[model samples]
Structures are given as C-alpha cells and as structure tokens.
Target: MSADIVFSDATRLAELIRTRQVSPVEVVQAHLDRIAAVDPKVNAIVTIAEGALSAAKEAEAAIMAGRELGPLHGVPFTAKDSIDTAGVMTQRGSPIFKGRVPDTDATSVARMKKAGGILLAKTNLPEFSYWIESDNLLSGRSNNPWDLDRTPGGSSGGESAAIAAGMSPLGLGTDLAISIRGPAAQTGIVSLKATHGRVPMTGIWPRAPRRFWHVGPMARSIRDLALAFSQLAGPDGLDAFATSAVPFDAGVGTVPDRKLKVGWMVGPGFGPIDTEVAATVKAAAEALKNEGHHVEEVHIPALERDFALDVFNKLHVMEMKPAFREATAGHEDQMYTMAKTMLSLPDTSMEDYIAAEQAAERLRDGYATYFRDYDVLLTPVLPVPAHKHGITELVVNGETVDLTYLQGATVPLNVTGLPGLSMRFGTSREGMPINVQLVGRWQAETTILHAAAVLEGVSTVRGRHPSI
Candidate 1:
C-alpha cells in the first residue's frame, strides 16, 4: 500500500475509487494491513471481519461495471463494538456477552454498508459501555496511540484510537455523556455528536434513556465527518425517538458567507480549569477572532443556577440501573466496580425522577435562550488530557476533582440534547492531546462543522498521527 493512500481521508479515497485511480479492494486491503501491523499495540480492534476483503472485491466489481455508487463508495471504516454488526461478535468489551453475535446489522451500520463503506472491524469500549476508560474482561484494555499508559477516552476510545493511528479514516461511535467527543479530543481526531434522536440508535447496547444517547461519525477530517454524516443521519424507523426530523446540510465544500458569532467559556461553570487547558481553548478562540469571527467570553446562567453535577448523576444512575441489571445479571463477576456501584443505587422514586426530568427540560430551554444570541458556545472537552489508566479523580490547577468534573462542561449539553463537536486544539506540556468542544443550536451540526473546519485549517495539530 502506498503511504499517501494510507493517510488520505475518506473523501479523497472515495474520489480516487470513483475515478478508477484505486480499487475498493486495494483500499480495504491497505487498512487491513495497517491494522494487522499496529492494532496489537493499541488494542483498538476487537474483531476483524473475515469477509471484508471479499465484500471489497464485490464493490470493485460494481465500479468496473460502471454502476452508480453511494456517498461513501469504497471507503473503509470501523464501528464501536456496542453497535451490533450482523455475524460479528459484539462483546461490548465485557466477557458477559462473550461469543454473542447479532443476526442483523444495527440501523446505522446497515446505513454505512449500504453507502458502500466496508466495515473492517468492531472496536473496543468499556464494559457495557459504562466508563471513561475502554477496558473489560473479554477484550482487555484499549491503550492510547499517543501514550499506551494513558487512556483513550471511552466508550468510543477504540474507534478514536484506530482512526487516529490511520488504520481507518472513518468510524462510528455513540455518545451518552462524552463518549465520542472525549475520545476524539484525547486522540486528536474530529467527531460529531449529532442532535439527540437525529441518528437511529437501534441495535446499540444499553438502549434506554434515548434522550442522552447519540450515534454519529468519527473521522480524521471535518469534511470526511460531513461525508459520513450524510450517510448516517435521518430516521431509521426502528428507534422510536429517531424522529422524521431532517438534518440540515453539513456544507462540506461551501465556505461560510459571513463571520461566525462564537461564545467562549474556558473553565468549568462551577470553578476554574487547569492553566494549560484554559490556555489552549483561549488560543482557539483567539484564532477564530483573527479569522474574522466575533468571539467573546460568555457565561452559562443555567449551569450556574442548577446543580449540574448532582442532577446528571441522579438521572444517569436512575436510568442505568435497570438496564445494567438485565444486561449483567448472569455475569456479575465480569462487571466493573463502578458498574456494580451504579447498579446498587436505590431505585429512584417516580416523583423524584419526574422532577429531574422537569429540571432537564428547563435546562434545555435555558440553553435555547442562550443560543438565540450566539451562533455557538465553546468550552474545553475535559479539564485534563488523557489521564493515567484506572485513575478516576483529576487534579486541575492544584484542586482535586473527581471524574464527574471531567464531564462538567460536557454533560450539560447532553442534558440539553444539543449538538456538539470535539476536535484537537493543542497539545499539553506533557505531550498529551488537548481538545475543545463547539456546541451548536438544535439540529445545527453545520455551524459546528464550519467552525471546526476553520479551526482545522489554521491549527498546526491537524492530522498529527501517534507513533504507536
């Protein structure tokens, strides 16, 4: 395989295949070779599909016959193990479901396959897709491509690691609290958390509380993300919450008509952030302003007024316990400690759950009001870069904070059900990846991508691969 072909984005690869410069079989084989060489070190891919090469050959035959192709024609990609793939063992990183294989593809997986993207493998995740680190009894741990000792944030860590290492140019991931975005930030890739219910969640594990779950694309470039989004967005009829709401175009090649109005908030709403993280976000904001966008520091009033952390934990724990009970009942020995603790929480009273639901609606309304004045809101994806494996608490700017603090800036958006995108902004003094998130208005993924694309153009960190 040529070096240029291996590093090219999905957009370029698809274009090449369309024009007959390269065949689909060649492209898939190249990624397969890369994965064989590097995945042992990263532990990103849990199962390599044995039939991927044959499928690529079929795609190549269609091209030779001059048949019209789908949007992602001939591109190779991976899916998170939590998303079911027909005939493949989707262990979800836990030994509890060892050797389990679904009879049909998840809605999103089928969509990507129909678009002519070959699924090369199923990536790793936390047990039952629960934690921020991707490790479980079945597949072991997924290490960061940048630093093996540090984690690639979960539950989409495996997807991000594979894409960052150039094993695959595009992949699919689900985000509840910060799965997709956090891993993208940690791995220095780009990811989109489409508006809640915009993408179907059928066949994904832990499928309750659809309000917090989203399935979307992860890629090395914003344009490739746009390409993947075009194929994955829309209602699949299986997920009840996957409404018929059509997403606005992502504006892949078109330039913005005017300067964007951006709001910047660096630290956690409750407190200050680490100095280096704060600086990285500030630098991104300054770059946006220099590019002619109107950038200003803004406060989230709802965050200041609400017990954001407490509300998130209560709602998450209440909704997750029942699902955990059912999915892990027979395999308690295989579950993680945190997963067990969450299961032990007393069931929430109907009254308390109702009040929390009402509070969530109010918070959503508040963010709606805030977005009325600004095009997008910006913040750090996490207080620190990828932390050491198995360490939950983080020390930021001399204050000790828990893992909940890692989601401080991210969870509120999940509660509000807003669209968010995470991309690499700068590297930390420790050489870890620093990420910033851009939150857009409801169904406004285009706005976020446009801002991210602009950032990608000026930033020096774009497409910097890890050595592992």
Candidate 2:
C-alpha cells in the first residue's frame, strides 16, 4: 500500500485523497518513508520538510470537517534547493551559503502550496545551479536511481532523481538552457519548461542571465505537469518577465479538435546524436503520424547557420560571470568546477557578444518561420542517454564533442523563449531512459503538452520505474 501511494502520480493521489479512499497523512507519510528508505542511496533529498506531517494532518482535518479542499490538498511535492521555501534551508548547493533560509517562498513554491500541495522536501543541485550534473561540495552528489554510478542530470538533477525513484511524486525545478529538460530525459520522468516568462522566477538564485532562466514542474506524469502549470502560469508581479496573463488550458489529455502538423529532427541544427536517440525521435514522430497528425522530417536553416549552443555560450558567459564572481568573492575555495570554469573563461568580446545577439534573432526568426506551418517540433532531449557521473567528454555518432553538447538541442528553446517539454519515449540498450523533446512556438505550451499526452497514450514504457 505504501509503495502504491508513493508511486502514484500527483493527479491520482489527489483524486484518491479527495474521494476519501486515502487520508492525507497516509499519502504524505508514504513519501516520507520512501525518502527515508531510498534517499541515502540516491542522495537526492537535501532536507526533509520538518512540517510535512503537520501540514498533512491539517489537510486531513479539513477533509474530515467536510470543508472545501484545493486540487492538491493531500499531495506531497518537492522543490530544487535553489528555490526558496520560507523557513527551509535553501543552500544553493554551495557551502558559501551553508544554512541560508529565505523569509518567503519563491513564486513557484508559493503557488504550489496555494493549490494545496504540501512541501515534502528540498532536492539537490549543482553549485549555484550552474552545471549539467547535480553534484556540489554542499550536498555531495545526486546519483541516478536507475544506476547508482550514473547521474540523473543537473542542475535539477536531484529533483529528477527524486521523482524517478518515487521519493516525491511532483516537484519544482528551474532551468537555464538544458537544466530541466536534460535532467528529465536522464531520469525517465516528465517536465515542462513552459514559454519563457510563463512561470515567474522570483526567489530563485543567480539572478544573472535572468532572461534564460525558467522555473517549472517535474513530475511522474504529463497530467501532473498540466495541473501544476495551470496553477503556476500567471503573473507574480515580482518577476517582471512573468507578465504573461495568457490562460493555460489544463486539459492536457483531451484530443485537440484540429489535426496538428509536426516536424521532427535529430541533427544538423543540433549536434551529432546517438543512433538510439535519433531513432527514438523518429519513433515519437511516427507515433504522432500514426495518430493522424501530419509528421515530417525537416530542418531550420538558421540553426545550421548559427548553433544555438554557441549563441547561448557567447551570450550567457558574459552575463553570468559577474554573478559568479560576486557570490564566490571571499569564498573562492567554495566554488565548484562549473563556477571556476565560468570565472576562468575569457570574457565574451563586445563585438562577439553583439554578433551572437544577431545570431539569436536569426534562430528565433527561423523557428518562427517553421511554426508558420508546423504546430509542434520534436527533437531528442539529449544526444545520448544518462551518462556516468564526472565524465567530461562524450563521443556521439563518430564525433567527439564537449560535454556541453548535451545542451545543443535544448538551449535553442531558451534562446527563442519557446515552450518545450521532456517525456520518456524510449529506453537505451544499457537500460537508461531516453526522452524526446516536444517544442512549441512561444506561449503555445498547451499545444505541446496536449501532444505529449497523446504520445503518452501510446508509450511502450509508460509505467516503468527504476527498481532502486
């Protein structure tokens, strides 16, 4: 019974609690017990919420009193440590701020709590949430539940690992470039990096390079993402970027009335991709094609001309370094590999930075042009599956590429402010999870999310979980 409660998606858990089939205490306790049993091995959880059971009891009292309840009344959720949670310690994965605690919840976290989601714990992350893997001197490291030796992906690595391991059913994660999507693919869960500015970034760390950073939900099912997004997508007034008042339709599983045009790609714009990963993208396209959508293989000329990863690197390094320098000022020894690397790289020349800005415009124009005909773009979330931790370089399709290539397919969405989601659609030969990215034009989250739900219906590995 505990296993069933822990593994159930947030939507189901909410329904079960709503109907009185399960008590709030049981639901929250199951997750707490699961975290206690599995977190030591995974190292995904950084701090367990001290008030979780207390909150759960309150939810139970509300139910017993026959009072109205919120959508997530009894459902437990976690947050990446980078997101502030009132009294909970949010160390930002660095010893520099070892016992830091915020006086208020991040907009995302507050919104989740507003909708009746109980904060269960805080997950780990790379130092200052800057790297592609979740390891830092503060939280040690987060290992993939599927294979202890491998990473679950990062900066949101701990959030992904927790959800994948059934430690938490749903959670909040922030992304800059590949953070959210890459980690989701690595862990076989589902996550949505909604249209930039759709969710506020208030109370999250490293405010530099703010335009590229995003906060969103990572969950075990597409429906949970839809529910979370519906609650999270309005303006918070605090984050000026989150001024989009667009209404998000939470009807994710419902079939759209119009037949959709979908385009799938694995290369040319994105760097070299593993054969298995490319096949998976094609497979997702085929699945959509089989479902009566018009699917085709296509390329954006702008992406080939100016790689998104290069554009992001040239622009963000200039924008991000000062923040890193400021945070690590007196505590230089506390800096991690990602921060040290950022501090060491030569500043982006003013001339090159201006050029990259132009390149970014072109890439956005290219995607805008493509979206004139296609409703959705499908791509591999990662060039390869979850890799062993601490490895620097990866060889893909006979080409040796820097570890940063993992962001090749994802950074473009950040550059263009397009909405994208990651959901598992395939399994690697070594048994690691493989995911395909579903991208939509700016503010078209509903379209991609609905498409993801349709694909979820036909997924061969739908209910599979790590055996940790």
Candidate 3:
C-alpha cells in the first residue's frame, strides 16, 4: 500500500468507497499495512482484530452489490481500550483488567460500526484511564509519534499517536478533564470533546461519576473529526446522563458565510500561559482578524476567582473516590503511585462538596454569559508543548510550575460541560507541536469546526506528518 492511502482522511476515503473508486477491503488493508510499519515504534495499538480484513472484504462485496451503505462505509478506525468492544480484550492499561472482555460493544463503538466504520484495533491509555500519560502495567507505554522520548498526552495518548502516525485515519476517545484535547494538541492532530453527555459513556472503564465524562472523536483533520462525531453523538438509553437525540449538523466542508465574532484570551482565565504558546495563540487570533472576523481580547470573570480548580478538584475526587476504592481495593500495589496517593486522601466533607458544586454552577453560568457576546473563544490548549515522558515538573518561561498548571485552560470547559476543539497551530523552536483550543457554547461544535478549518488553511502547522 502507498503512503497516500494511509494518510487520506475518513471523509475522502468514504467518498471513494461510496463512488466505487476504492474497495472497503483496500482501505482497511492500507491501514493495517501502516499499523504494521508504525505500531512497533509508537506502541499505540494494543490489539488488532483477528479478521478485520475479511470483514472489510465482506463490506466491499455488499457495496458492489448496490446495497445500502452507512455514513462511514468501511472506513477504518481505532478505539481507546477503555471503550469496550464485544469479544475483544479491553484491558484499559491495567493488569487487574487484563484479559477482560465485554459481552457488549460500547455505545460509541456500536454507533461507529453501525455507520460502517471498521474497528481495526484498540489503542492504549493510562492505567484505569486515570493519568495524563499512557503508561501502565498491562500494555506498557504509548510513545509520541514525533519523538519517542516525549509523551503524546494521556489518557487518549494512544489514539492520538496512532492517528498522528497514520496508523488510523480516525478513532474514538473519552475525555474526563483534558484527556482528548491534551493528546490531540501534543500529537498535532484534531480532536473534539463534545458537550458532556453528548456522547454516551456506557462501556468506558473507570465509569466516571454522573456527567463529567465524555466520549468524542479524534482524527488528522477537522472534517474527519466531524464525520466520526456525527456517527457517535446521540443518546444511548443505557447512560442516564445521555442527552436526548438531536440532529447533528456534520458541517464537514461547510464554512460559515458571515464573518465571526471571536473572543481571544491567553492566560488570564487559567493563570499564566507559556510565552511560546501565548505567542502562537495571538498569531492565530490576528489571522482570524485578517480574515475579516471581529476579534478582541476578553476576560472571563468567573476564572478570576481562586476557587475554580479547588471546586473542580473536590467535586471530581468526591465523585471518583467510590469507583477508585472499588477498583483498587485489593490491588493497591498494581496501581500508579499518583492514583494511590489520590485515593489515600481523607474523605471530603459533605459541606465542602456541596459548596464546590454550587461554585461550579456559578462558573457555568458565568461562561454562559461570556459566550452570549462571542461566537467562539480561543486559548492555548496547554501551557506548553509536549513535555518529556514521566517528568512531572514543568518549567515555563524559566519558572518551575506544577503539572496541574497544564490543565488551566482545559479543565474549565469540562467543568462547564461546554464543547471545545483542539488543532495544531504551530511548532516550537524545538520542533514540538503547539496547539490552540477553541471553546464554543453548548452544542455549538459546528461553529468551532468552521473556525478551525479557516485557521488550518492560513497556519504553518498544516500537512506536517509525524515520523513514526
């Protein structure tokens, strides 16, 4: 198979298959070939479905027979191990769950398959899908496709690495906090974290508390991300938090006709951002202004308060403690040190937890007010580019900062249950990918994708493939 076949986006491949220009079997074979060449270097793929090629051949035969086809129609994709696939091992990067196989497909997985997407492999993740780096006792570590010594960002790191390395054109990943967007930024790919509860979280490991978790799409291009999302988003009766089914406008190649009203901010909302990342975000903002969009520097008043992170941390821990205890009860030694430490914290008081929840409500309302005046908001995806693997301390602008600082811009969106998309904006002097994130109102992913498509065309970050 040629490199061109491996790099084609899902939208393009689907069009080819729809028009009989390429066989579904041929598309699946190209991805399998690319995975064979690159998986050894990135460790992104945990397991390859035994007979995916044969299944693809069957799909091709059905297509040639003039049978009805689904939206994806034989496009190959991967899923983070946390999302279960019936009859396949969904280890979830932990030894405790090793060899664990579910009897049912995750809602997201089943939806993609129903749309004719072939699941070729399962990607890696952090142990119990807890950490920000994809390393655990079961499948080992998933490395950055651009540089093995650096991390690809977690817990969706494996999905990001696989897509960045051309192993898969698109994939499914879960985001609880910054998991999806972080890895996408680090790997120079495009990923969307839909409004919480927009996609069902039913078969995901570490089944997150109520509505904090989300399942979304990761891909090389915004169009591909939107394509996969259209198939994945909707209510699955199994998840209580799932939203009622609503028609999603895929908006793949559709550009908004009118000029946009963009509100841009670098660090004030989430604290001080890295100088390099701030510079790139400013440049992106200026480029939007150049495109005739109205751009202005704006501050989110809710972020000025000190309790943002405190509220999020407390609420998260309160909801997570039960599951963490249940999962790690007898196997304390098998978990990551950070997970162990977090589990060891004293139980939070009900008074404090309630206060935090109230504070969160206020923050959400504040963002709702902010978005009322702007079409979209722009910020740095991370305070810095991908850091060295296993190095927790981050030095930014000559000052050492805690790892939690990296979550500044990302965590707020999770708290508000808003939609955010990450796209590669530029590369640092050291050649690492730098990304900018666009946050939109609830269920407004279309506007975010449109802005991302415009920026992708003008930025220097386009078409740079990672060497696996």
Candidate 4:
C-alpha cells in the first residue's frame, strides 16, 4: 500500500483521491511515512511542512462536504529550498539565510496549492542555488537513490532525489543551465524546463540572471509534467518576463496530423558524450522513427561556431557576481564553494560581454532556423550517468573534461530560452539512469510535451525506479 501510494504519479493520485478510493489524509500520510523511512539515506528533505497533514485533513473535509476540489487536491508536492514557501524554512542552502521563512509562497508554489496540491516539504539545494550538485553548508548534499555515493545533480538535486525515492510525488525545481533537467536525467525522473519566460521565476532566488532561469515541475510521469505545465503557465502579472499570452494545452499523446521532423545529435556542438549515452539518444530517435515520425541525425552550425556554455559563462558571471557580492557581504564566513568560485572568477571584459550577448543571439537564431524545418530536437541530457559525489572532473570517451561539461547539452536551451523536457530512456552499465532531451521552439511546449508522451509510451525504461 505504501509503495503504491508513494510511487504513484500526481495525476493518478489526484484521481484516486477525487474518487474517494483513497482519502486525502491517507495519501498525505503515506508520503510522510515514506520520507521518514528514506530521507535519512537520501538527505533529500531539508524541512517538512508542519501544516501538511492539517491541509490534508482540510482537503478531506472539503471532499466530505461535497465542495469543489482543485485538480491536485490532496496530492503532496515538494519544492526546492530555493523556491520560497510561506512559513517554511527556505534557507537557500546557505547559513546566511538559515531559519529564514518567507511571508508568502512563490508564484509556482502558490499555483500548485491553488490546484489542490499540498505543500509536502522543502528539499535541499546548492548554496544560493548555484553549482551542479545539491551539497551546501545549510542542508548538506543529496545522494542518488540509485547509488547513494553518486550525486543526484544540482541546485534542484534534492527535489529530484525526493521524487526518485518516493518521498515526494511531484516537485517544483528551478533551472539555470542544467539544474532542473539534468537532475531529472540523473535520477530517472521526468522534468520540464519550459521556454525562458513561459513559466515565471517570480519567487525563486538569484534573480540576477533571470533571463536564463526557469521554474518547472518534476514528476515520475510525463503526463504529470503536462498537467503541471498547464497549471503553471501564463503570466502572473508580476513577472514581466512571463507576459506571454500563449495558450497551452495538456495535450499528452495527441498525435499530430503530419509527420513530425526530429533531429538528434550528441556531439560536435555539445562536446564529448559517453558512448552509452550517445547510443541512448540514437535509440530514442529510432523509436520515434519506428512510430512513423520523420527522424534523422542533424546538427546546427550555430552551436558549433558559438559554444553555448562559453556564452553562458561570459554572460552569467557578469550578471550573477553582483548578487553574490550583495548576499555574501559581511557573511563571507557562511559562503559555500560555488559562491566563492563565482567571486574568484574575473569579471567579463566590456568587449567580451558585448560579444557574448551577440553570441547568445546567434545561438537563439540558430535554434530558430532549425525549428523552422524541424518540430522537435533530440539530444542527450548529460554526457554520462550520475557520477560519484564531489567529482570535480570527468573523463568522457578518454578525454578529461571539467565537471561543468556535464552542462554541455543542457545550457543551450537556457541560452536560447527554448523549452526542453528530460525523461529517462536508458540505463548505464553501472545501472544509473540515462535520459534523453526533447526540445521545441519558443512557446512550443505543447509540441515537446506531445513528443515526450509518445516517446514515453515506447521507453524500455518506463516504470523503472530506484531500488531504494
């Protein structure tokens, strides 16, 4: 009963509660119990929401009273500590902000609650939500459920770990570069990083580089991603960037009338990728072709000319350092590795900064040109599967590369402000999860979500979860 409750996706859980086959209180309690059982091993949870059970009881009362319920009513969802949650400790994974509680929930959190989701808990993250691993002085590091020694992958790592370990059925995670999708890939879960401004980053921290930042849902199923995106999309009136009046449909498995053109690539632009990971990308392309879509291997020349990672570093370092300087001022003692690293890096020269801005435009233009002909693009989410915690370097295909190269395949979407979804399609020889990325044009989330659901239907790894 506990396994069934904990592993069920948000969509299924909502159905069960709505039908009264399972009480809201029971659903919430089962998750709380699962957290108590596994969080110590995973360290995914930083602070449990004290009001969670009470909220569940209230949801139960509404059902008993025949009151209308929200779509997620009774379903429990977690948010990364970086995302503000009213009355919950959102410490931002640093001692400088320890014990701090926001007076209001982030737009993302409030919307999840508005749809009937219960606030389950706050999960761990890197300091100031920077870096590629979940470790920080505040809540410590999060370990992969698949292999406790391997990291879950960063800033949003704890959110990914919680869902992977059955501690949370759904979660909200922020992405700047690889944070959201990369962690989902590492954990064998599914997460969406919608177009830059599609989902507002209103209440997440480190808004200095807001252009590349995004907030999206992480879940065990592709349908949950679609459902959460439908609820979370549109302008909130506060975030100027989120002023898109675009219409979104939770169009899971909606087959298109014409054959969708998909291009898959693992190299030349994204740097070296593991052979196994590369093979997984090919397999996904093959599966799509088998399903009768127009599939072919293709590359964008823009990516080759202006490497997205280099552009991001040049732009973000200039934009982000000021925020770090402000936050860590006089509290340098509490600063973590990522904060210190950011401070140590030299500022981008005025000439380099302007060049990076132009390069960013080029990258965006590159994707725009490709999307003109192709409806979807497929690529590896990470060069390799989850690696041992604290690894500062990785050897991909015999060439030693900086650990940041793991962001190689993911940062392009951030630079281009394009929508991308991460879902597991294969497993490494070491049994770690390998996920493929599905990308679409700006404001074309419906297309990628549709593609994701179709690919999910044929995934050999569908329904697989960590033994933990």
Q: In every candidate, how many clashes are there?
A: 0, 0, 0, 1
Q: What is the Cα-based lDDT of residue 345 in candidate 2?
A: 98
- After superposition, the stretches of candidate 2 with alpha carbons farther than 4 Å from their true spots are 252-256
RMSD of each: 1.8, 1.1, 1.7, 1.1
Candidate 3, 311-346: lDDT as tens digits: 778888878888888888898878876578678887
Q: Which window of 10 residues has the lowest lDDT sum in candidate 1?
A: 247-256
Instruction: Rank by lDDT, highest first.
Output: 2, 4, 3, 1
What's the true lDDT of residue 251 in model 4?
Answer: 70
Q: What is the lDDT of residue 94 in candidate 3?
A: 78
Per-residue lDDT of candidate 2, residues 105-195 (tens digit) = 9999999999999999999999999999999998899999999999999989999999999999999999999999999999999999999
- TM-scores across all candidates? 0.96, 0.99, 0.96, 0.99
Error of 3 at 420 (Å): 0.2
Identify the superior model by TM-score, candidate 2 or candidate 3: 2
